[model samples]
Target: MSDIIAHTGSAFRLTLRRAGRSLLARIGCDCPLCGARVAGARLCAGCESDIAGSMADPAVPRCPRCALRLRHGHCAACLAGAPPFSRCVAAFDYEPPADILVHMLKSGLRLSMAPVLAGMMARACARQGLVLPAGAVLVPVPAGRASLRRRGMNPAAEIARALAGELDIPLARAVLARRRETPRQATLDRRARRRAAQGLYVCREPLAGRHAVLVDDVMTTGSTVRAAAQALIAGGAQDVTVLVAA
Candidate 1:
């Protein structure tokens, strides 16, 4: 009887401890990104300010098709001929701390950054006055099977899932698949990157009359996304848009 009483008391203490932690999390006194103590916020003030500053640079004019930095409103290349995607929206430039955050999320296995990045992307969309067609689906650029096996998760898919929840849209991961493995785009030049992305993705479901927004972690030359968008259009999507974290 004494042993039983002691066990019950320990269990009660553990339960109380768990409840306390839950309450603290709800209060959110610690920053999720930097782990600093904050006041009634998920991210600390410093981190918020840094993110805002990163997006305030005006020298990097935006390109409408790929959302990349360009000399003109839309790059001369994209203006010469548009890709399959209608528009592109990138939340931050791939520089400094923003690039570090993306690397951490991709290689460091920092899964918590997904929702934060998705929120930034949503804000970017709002700032650019981007609105999806009704019933549009969020399709993530599929990671290669080998990459998925090594990384244990797809960063693009993680971001897409979070963005879908934020926008109240359906996620369609099953519709697209990476049919062939390719070298990392970061390692290749523009010509090599284009060749590497060729025939990399395939669509399995009928996308006829369906609208889709492709989600990715970053866009460099935009070749990989263009390939994915082409696959979606070939599968019968009405149109596609590209959304990226940086």
Candidate 2:
């Protein structure tokens, strides 16, 4: 009798939570990209347009090899020694709007916004003519135990699944796993971050000859993605690309 009552109570709370999200989504219509509260849309149309415009703009210089915004076609560091990833691209600046969106999506359990963000990414890919040949895989950045536990779900994987659906590619979560629950990247310095994440990820599946695209909620110093890319390369992938949530 007690178990039944507890289960019912938990179910009620879950339903209420969903209802609250629906109400908030309708009242404020959370912007999927900026987490802004606006009227009449899952993503306030203006914020969507702004982020889309940033992606479409030609003014943003990116490294051809890593896809990071460079002063020119390439950054000297990349030119001298490129990372493991074949390409890397971000949809927007790491600053406001995009930052808020990434934070909310990861910490607020806003899985509802994944599709909207995926659509934005699909459009960006189309505009850039990123060719994901069939069999190309979308592998979201693996999260440490702590991050996954805190969110109750892997936000990066959720975004990757939505992106894969939009792009008609395969989502491959099994290829990579976070082996070490290390210090948070946001808290560590660039060097410390790299050291902390060193060999922290393991490739669990065959990636040989496969075109793999790594997905993540955000990119800061690029060490985490780079480390994961190294693991992917070691896994036998032909090349690795990074698709950072704008």
Candidate 3:
């Protein structure tokens, strides 16, 4: 009986969310990044183009594992030892107008920007020719308690929800859980960030033989996603791929 109630509640919430999105599409709104008026979209065409142009240049050298930009050779960290994830795909570099989208979603609490970011992420996957194997599932990195209390929503989970809809994939919303809250990664050095993220996440679901597409809003040092991927692998996922809004 409890399971039936939970499933019904989830269905009700999903229906309400879809209705809200449809209403927004009909009314139209201004672009969140810029002040430009947009019709039936959250981002203006100019802003979208700027974001598309900000994607990592295919010609530039980068780490095959983490997608970190490189001057000539692959990233030293990835070279010394590859990250747990198979590959990382970012919609755009974390800069300028693109950064604004993340800020709006996270700090500004503009939940409507999620689908816009997800659409771009889906396009980024296409640009990279990324193909998910059968039984691939989207799993969002869970937010810390402090962030959830402040923002009232996890930006990564919101993006993952929209991404799942865009890609027509299943979303394992509660598969990964945060073990404990630590200092913000932005406040720590690279090595410290990795240490802080160690064993920070745990997988609650069995993912044996399934491909996991990890989703996040932005990845700086990649410590968070790396930790999450390790947890997924430990949970028996075949492999993990990272997709971020940047």
Candidate 3 residue pairs that clash: none
TM-score per candidate, chains pooled: 0.81, 0.78, 0.86
Kindly list the per-residue Cα lDDT of model 2 for residues 1-246, writing each as its tens digit. 999999999789767865654565456555555657775334666776776576556787666666666775568647666789877666667777666766767777777767566656676677777887667899998888887778888888888987876676778987898886897777889789878878888899988799899988778777788889989999988888788776
Worst 10 residues of 1 by lDDT: 20-29
Q: Give the whole-model CA lDDT for all candidates, comma-separated.
A: 0.80, 0.75, 0.87
Question: Candidate 3 — which residues are off by over 4 angstroms?
Answer: 1-27
**What lDDT tens digits, residue by residue, belong to model 3 across residues 1-246?**
999999999899878867776776667677777778777655787887777764655676767678777865758777666799999998888888578888988988888889889988988899889999989999999999988898999999999998987776889999999999898667899999989999999999999979999999998888899899999999999999999998
Identify the leading candidate in terms of TM-score.
Answer: 3
Q: How many backbone clashes does candidate 1 have?
A: 0
Winner of 1 and 3 under lDDT: 3
Off by over 4 Å in 1: 1-46, 52-58, 72-76
The digit string of per-residue lDDT tens for model 1 on 1-246 reads 999999999789767865654464466455666789765423576776676444546765666567667765559658766888999888878887667778878888888778777867877788778989997999999998778997899999999987875676789988888887887666789989988987788999998889999999998888899899999999999999999988
Could you tally the backbone clashes for each prediction? 0, 1, 0
Query: Of 1 and 3, which scores higher on TM-score?
Result: 3
lDDT for 237 (candidate 3): 96
Q: Which is the winner by lDDT between candidate 2 and candidate 3?
A: 3
Q: Best to worst by lDDT, what's the order?
A: 3, 1, 2
Q: In model 2, what are the clashing residue pairs, if there are any?
A: 66-88
